[model samples]
Target: DSFKSAAGSQTAKVQQVVTSPDGEKRYWFKLEGGQASPGMGDSPEPVDATITQDYETAAAMSKNELSGTAAYMSGKLRVSGDLMKLMQLQGALGQMPTALKGIDVDY
Candidate 1:
């Protein structure tokens, strides 16, 4: 899958929480040994990092319209734990837009 290829040997468990008017949506992106996948709800395993942002910010990031670093610097995103690990996963994260191409998503 595109996600696996994008992961490319980088290993990390990342918890992403997106807040919206309805509520919060939680997802876990687990990357290991050149493979990666996402799961809904809380991460079963201890995560290397957690990122929380509003729905708009999350959508922007997913669409590649906003960079994580930029979001964090602008106070639109919040990150906790293992900052270096999250920083290292930027390449993998940057692949999100390409990886999700053609998927039908409302937001």
Candidate 2:
């Protein structure tokens, strides 16, 4: 249940800090392909990692103009979570390809 615990911890952080356009913040990540689904009733809540960037910045990053760490530090991306969990996730994510599906990058 490590994944669940990780997800729960992340959900708590997102709920505490993120908000939607109407001032409501709620989200979840759908784990499809590459990994098994956590199963019904065991999925983690979603979160939005907002990246404040224009098309150019996005395009550049998409083309590998910046590394993930660099993007984060430069304000191209922002994330919220338990620092430990976040770091763990980052390590996992570092093993993934920058691009997923048709998206420029996984972010």
Highest-scoring model, TM-score: 1
Encode model 1's per-residue lDDT on 1-107: one tens digit a residue: 66667677888999999999899999998888876677999999999999999999988888889999899999999998999998887877877777877788886
- Output the lDDT of residue 68, model 2: 55
Cα deviation of 95, candidate 2, in Å: 4.0
Error of 1 at 72 (Å): 1.1
Q: Provide the clash count, candidate 1.
A: 1
What TM-score does each of the candidates earn?
0.88, 0.39
Candidate 2: which stretches are off by over 4 Å?
1-28, 31-58, 98-107
lDDT of candidate 2 over 1-107, digit per residue (tens): 33333333322212222233444333233433333232222225553332244444444554656655776688765665444544545533333234232444443
**Residue 93 lDDT (model 2):** 37
